[model samples]
Target: MATPTTSTGASNKLLLAIIAIFLPPLAVALKEGLTGTFWLNLVLTLIFFIPGIIHALLVVL
Candidate 1:
């Protein structure tokens, strides 16, 4: 018999989402590895906090 394995993707995303609530740019960077989207999120975060959180949630979750 083969042992069953569980995926951690969902839990990782949840953690990212929670991190996004506090630090949107960091979550984006972690998810995207400092890509363009991360840059955009950083800008948004710098401009406004709520939009940053929204963008992070959108990207992470």
Candidate 2:
């Protein structure tokens, strides 16, 4: 029998989303790394919206 594994892509996306909510820059850096321009921008945008806060809290905690 083989152990089942979850998809990291989905998980990472969720994690990034969470991180972006609280700390946009930090979350972007963690999720996307140096090449995560989209994530950073989204995080910044999140600052103006509710999703951003959710992302930040989830990522930080």
Candidate 3:
């Protein structure tokens, strides 16, 4: 049986993954805080959108 925290975490991941498909940087920020990955995602998003989405999905999942 999954604990409440586990269930919530899973749901949060799912939501972040969905968001990653759209706003990659925001998703990365949510998952990883304002760290290097967030900045990397922002740069990737500015350079090319698809790579940012891919990176964000990788980070989230």
Compose the digit string of candidate 1's lDDT tens values, residues 1-61: 4333324666788899999999999999999898999999999999999999999999988
Q: In model 3, which regions exceed 4 Å deviation?
A: none
TM-score to native of every candidate shown: 0.84, 0.42, 0.88
Worst 10 residues of 2 by lDDT: 1-10
lDDT of 2 at 43: 57
Ten contiguous residues with the weakest lDDT in model 1: 1-10
| 13: Cα error in model 1, Å | 1.0
lDDT of each: 0.90, 0.58, 0.97
Q: Per-residue lDDT of 1-61 in model 3, one digit per residue for the tens?
A: 9999999999999999999999999999998899999999999999999999999999999
Candidate with maximal TM-score: 3
